[model samples]
Target chain A: MTTARAGALLDRLGRVGQFLWSGWAGLAGLALFAALWQAGHERYGDFILPAPLATLAAGLTIAADPAAWELAGQTTLRAVEGFALAAAAGAAGGLAAGYSAATMRLARPILTVLLGVPPIAWIVLAMIWFGSTDGTIITTVLVAATPVVFVGVAEGAVTRDRGLDDMARAFGAGPLARLTTLGLRHVAAFLFPALTVALGSAFKVAVMAELLANTGGIGGALAAARANLDVAEALAWVLIAVAGLIAVEYTLVHPIRSEFERWRNAARPWGVKR
Target chain B: MTRETTDAAPSLTLSGIGHAYLGRTVLDAVDLTLAAGEVAALVGPSGCGKSTLAHIAAGVVEPSRGRVARRYRRHGMVFQDPRLLPWATARANIAYPLRLLGLPRRERRERAEQAAQRVALDRADLDKFPIELSGGMRQRTAIARALAIDPDFVYFDEPFTALDVALKRRMQDLVIEAARGARFGALFITHDLMEAVRIAHRVVVMDAHGRGIAGTRAVPGKPGGRDDGTVYRLVAGFLSDDPLFRHIHDIDERRTP
Candidate 1:
């Protein structure tokens, strides 16, 4: 029993070690990329390109400023709100299209049109309606993200096991029960990937829309930095925004995705080791 | 033995049952009756409408032309594939049909455990996902799922085809034992005549064209005393001498020996 307890502890430690190794490898790759960027800046000079050290100093300066946090908060809020709205709408739409052939046919043309129109084009429309505000940023993010979620969920719905559905019917599972137990379970797998991609897209689109509309966010700070030709500060703000994106993706999106896919991951070769 | 209720009606009936797929005739004017507690096997050639007939009986596919009537309110099925939900645990898969019946969670779990025990599935394996299981284990889970609801009628479509000979025999025994209790009637489809004879009270042979039921033979006595030798002779006799059974077994003989 003591030996078995020791073995279990060793196994736990081994998993932690593997996780750390992978995390370090990823960090090393990012560091290497940054070093190359710094070398390129040294060759080109600071006006056109900023070194990693200069960018980091500028980032620290921005981090110290209360206004920078306020702008970051605005961008974060808009992106999240847009993403939440897009997820709800897309899931509802996807469920409808998945369950009903008529709804799918009717909605296909409209979704296609919406998906085909570029995020930038939507920003123009948003600007016309909401005009240089958070609403414009949110609308742009919504247009860019909803289709990813919709298509993900629709594909999931289409691929649902007819056998299970038949089993459910044989057992007299009501429509609502079927949807909750079988339908949602299948769709959950696709929904996470869709949400992850949409969330990332939401951040990028929200920031870009803010930059274009001159709204009060990190995008406006980027615009100001560009206007002043403060290349290091601009690069720093870009890095800060990217870091925020990674943070949100890791902390929010990944945890939810992992929770939904824990069973799936447990079946995978690598996932079994952990 | 409990006598079948005379007023209960037949568990299932197929009269003048005919089916075709994309202009190819599979079953023709097949007439079959399954009283409550009867276990019948539909056996024939690969292209014979055994599976198609099973599908028709299960209401997964509509018959091209025929009349099928069932007294049972609930029916369960096991396919050639395990067909358990990849996302769900073995217990959950077994409980799935019960969940549809709106059984409370406690009742569902209890029934699932009982069904798994009936199939000789280990209690430890209950929480394991389908992907975590071996092929035989998965098939056992499927059997457990089908039996979990204590279905009045069950349809099995070549369910043990993937199993090894030993595992196949074990599963056959489970089905035979389950049927003997009179809790369920089953329409079992298979190309293996020996398998049919081992478990079925009556075996129906379908025509190659799948147009209809061509022939049927009753295997006398309970399946418990029937050895493999008895099953082989029965299949061999049907293959060579029985005129009604001849066509279905001809192709299998050419392929096997």
Candidate 2:
């Protein structure tokens, strides 16, 4: 019993050590980039390039303002809402297209047309319909993100292990049970990566749409800062938005992704020892 | 006194079973019967539709113009490959059929444990997935799964062909022991005559053309735990000089020669 307890403690220590190592690496990379930015500022005047400290001070000022939180929250809400809709629609559509050749053939042309068009092209059309509202921003994100998710899910469905499906059928698994258990389990791996990409794209597209439409958000605040020739403030808002994106990715997406990836990580072939 | 049904009537029957793939006939007018409580081993050369026959019997394939009647309540099958779900552990794989039948979780796990014990699978291996298992263990897991449902009719399609000699013998003994309980009947398909004589009550040799049964031989002793020497001479002599057995055995020789 004592030995078992000791072993458990040792394992915990090892995990802690690994976590610290990764954290140190990330901090080191950030420090190196900041140093380079500071050096560039010293070489060039503040008019051309702001110092790293100046950027950080400007970012702190914006972060203290209540309006910045409201704008950040708006952009985040639109991005997440649009992403959820795209994920659901893409998965459903992809399943239908993947399972039936006829449906795939019918949907192929439509998917091609949507995927081919640039997100900028949809901006004007979205503005006309929604008149520069959050609806336009959400629509822009959906247009940019849905096809990426569709292709991932469709490939996942097409490449599903038929043997498992046959076994499930032989053992009398009903259609819904099979879909929930086997179909979704197989698609989860592909869907998660696609989701990460789509989530990232949603944030980018929503911000772009807000900026283009001159709506009230961080994007609009950025435009106002630029109009006032407050380059430091503009860059600071951009930094704050990026930091928010990183925070969301780490807290929301990364944890969920790692939960799903544990299985994959366990299956990976740890390199052969010499 | 109550009169029982005739034992002569086949428990399972296949009449004029023929299968063709793209105008090429693989099995032609094959008539076969499996008596209740009988263990029959079907042996023939490669591509003689041995596996195909097993598949047809297991209802995985539908013959072009044939009917298979089963007097048994349920049929369980083990293929040449173990065919266990790679993601599921050994215990879970064994309990798959029971899960399909909607048994409660406790009951399923209990039955799976019982089945694993019967097949001599160690307790430590129960939670290990297919990739973590040895080849013989995988096959043993497959056998346990087939037996977990207590199937009245079991079809084994070259199940031991991939195992090492010791593991193969152990598996063969397990099959024989299961068959001897009188709870199940089996249709064992293999190309090995010695294995056929060792385990089966009656051995039916299929002709090369897959037309009909070429020959039938009754094994002298009980189905399971028979001494190897008792049937060794008969099997060896038939395989060496008997013209009917000779035709199928010669095919293996010709390739190597």
Candidate 3:
């Protein structure tokens, strides 16, 4: 038992080392993107597009202030709250639709209508309903993020292995046991990727709604920069928003997803390693 | 005079079992019984509804008409494919049914390891995922999973049909040995007469149209006791001369219900 436990620990450590090592490739990709940004800045001039280094300096200056931190934190909190609600509602709805044919048929047309309406349109509607507050930003984020998660989870549920279900039944598993053990585990593969997409949109829509609703967040800071024609400061706020997204995606979403998908890594060839 | 014969009771009884998929009838008026500690190899032609019958008997499919009575304490099953959970490690896959039964984690682990050892699966291979294991090892893990439940009866639905010749023989030997040691009754379903003659105490052939059981032939000796020459001769003789096995080799995939 001790040896088995040790082996599992070692396996986990190896995967963690591999994950950290893969950051080099991520950094290289980022550097390439920076090179493209620099080329754009040099061509357009500072007034049109600030240089990457100048933006970083401005972002650092903003980061030094305690008030700027609150602005960033307020936006993060709104986006994360909306994302949590979306995940819960979408998963429940998707699981319902996936297991029942009648529910799936009904949900499809409604989902189509939901996806067909633009996030901007919903933001306008939410602004009218909830006014210029956190409510407006959160409502817009929920509308934008829920459909992505719902579609992914529903598809996951629909395509589950019937053979496995039969195998489970033959072993005397009841419906509830089958659902918890097999159905949920199968759906998780589809859930994580949908969550990543939904999360990305959650942050994007939160920022957009904050700007339109005139709530005091990074969006409000951006509005101030726009009023004074401070292009570098606006770019710096955008940089900070993107940095928050990266931090949350890496620290929260990616780690949990990797833990669930470690078996997939074992299937990969040794030479490919990724 | 009344006699107490609890030991002589059948492990399973299926009476007038019938099934249909959509509107198409796949099985009709089928009845089968398995006595305690008897390994019955059910053989039939392709598309003969043999698998459907197995599924119905195992309660994986609800029969359109009939009754199924299982007297065994608990049961386990192995399918044609390994059916090991791809996202789980081999050890976890073996322990899956135990988890379903709500066994404590420690006992689950111990039983899973013991089952693995019964199938001669290497201890190190238990940690690997289904994708990491070879075809033979994966099937072995599946068999181990079935054994882990400590079942009094088992259902094997063409469990070794996917393996190569040598691997198939090895798996058959493993099942034979396992059945001998565990003394569990089993309903072994396969289309191969040679396999049926090799592993089963009695070989049952189903009707071509799945109307009913065509006939049954008792093998001369216990499974794992018969020599290769005896098994080969019996299969050949049945194929060439036995009227009951005339259509056992027939294949029509389009006719499968």
Candidate 4:
């Protein structure tokens, strides 16, 4: 390669290095979290609280076990399925409710009642209705997560820039084009943050419902660990569930959210170009 | 310089236009005719229903009592503010009308680029969103958008009122060029008599109460080349000579006993 071409390659490598360094900085934050865990371990006895290293050892052993994979997969699948259904339902319902005042007035009270009932109450009902199956876990997750997503999407749609809508209308844009392009872009802004919270809620509600219903998952594994008084194993299962949540969030949801929000950077003086 | 000698009728005509809002009478029986290839500047006070008249002509708002006859193919509008899409780049905003017409993505991009070039937007600026551009650049993008579909007529609702003086004058030059070159009839609304005098083939004056069009005065020069001295002379003559134009400065003399 020519000297200039080689120099450009080096410049690209330097940018890659900078990006990796930023990720390493995030790892440093996890190290601080480890130190706090160590503090908690030192305060309590071995039976009550395990050391961070001990939990790591337990987590690794669980990761290697074939049965543990089945538990992990069930929990992840149910949580994901539940969250996806809620997101779709919420988005469509919210678009309708946000655009129409009559729908909003009717939905507001119904949504309020839905949000008021706890997931545990729903789990009891779900268990009685669907038995100790994946249905219980998934239903609980959906019930817990849907209301938050609906509120965010509804507010986003209602607060859209009417002027922009008028501009689009004057240009003769069809209804579908205007809704997808103009309406959805604004909704995504509110939807992403709500989805983050909802996803987290979905996992928590799923795990709780599984434990209560005694369906096979990380929650069942934790219950067994608790019966045997294995603090390290219980904590290990909790850590695995969280790691899955973070993995899905950072890899799937976050990238999509950032792609939609890329336009906002242009408004800033020092824009964050990818 | 000359009106269309072809057999085609006027591009737009407002016949006995009248409008009222929420039981308040704003405009009544205002008749105006804009021929093909002509620019009619509407000068009146802010509340003199100038914008209302423009809106009525553009079919943006239906008149309470008259008919608007549009003999043209496509009509475009430029508002006081740039009113650009915050998310779209300058080129995309310019190409928006075409997109609405269901053009393909590649064609839209090409047409948008061509439109951007018409308003003298640099290649770099065309890719920048509205918030990234200067106010003048934003307005230019708006104008580019207005002219993109090869409109037969355009409504200028005080489009340049938000720009700086120098930028406004530059924009006026662009408008004049577009007005003449495209042969599109325009209904230019403004409160500034100087702006109206600079580019209008005919200056339409409204009564002080904004109830009706009081008079119409034809400017001596063509749309693009009027000298400031001639504009000043005509403005002076309108204020001093015409009854409705004179009403702007007159303080009702029927006040005392």
TM-score of chain B of each: 0.89, 0.92, 0.96, 0.91
lDDT of 3 by residue, B1-257 (tens): 11122257888888998888888888899888777888999999888899999998888999999999999999899999999889999999999999999999999999999999999999989889999999999999999999999988889999999999999999999999999999998999999889998998888889888888888887888899999999999999998988888888876857744
Which regions of candidate 4 fall more than 4 Å away from where they truly are? Answer: A1-21, A270-274, B1-8, B16-30, B62-65, B206-212, B246-257
Candidate No. with top lDDT: 3
Number of backbone collisions per candidate: 7, 0, 0, 0
Give the DockQ of candidate 2: 0.29
Candidate 1 per-residue lDDT over residues B1-257, each given as its tens digit: 11223344688988988877687666789887887777888887886667878888888777888898988867888989888888788998999888777889989999999999989999889878898899999999998888888888899999999899999988999888876764688899998888888988788777766666666678866666788778888878877877877666456533421
Task: Report the lDDT tens digits of candidate 2 across residue range B120-236.
Answer: 999878877787788999999989988888888888889999888888889999998887763687899999888898888788889786777787777676766578786788688
Top model number, TM-score: 3
Q: Pick the candidate with the highest DockQ.
A: 3
In candidate 4, residue A10 scores what lDDT? 86
Clashing pairs in 4: none
Q: Indicate the docking level reached by candidate 4.
A: acceptable
Off by over 4 Å in 3: B1-7
Instruction: Report how far off residue B222 is in candidate 4 (Å).
Output: 1.5
Model 4 Cα lDDT, one tens digit per residue, A1-274: 2874687588557645644556676788999999988898899868788898999999999999999999999898999999999998888888899989999999999999998897789999999999998888888898888888999999999999876775665555667988987899788899999999999999988888888899979888888888898888999999999999988887778767755665676675542443
Docking class of 1: acceptable
TM-score order of candidates, best first? 3, 4, 1, 2
Each prediction's DockQ? 0.47, 0.29, 0.82, 0.46
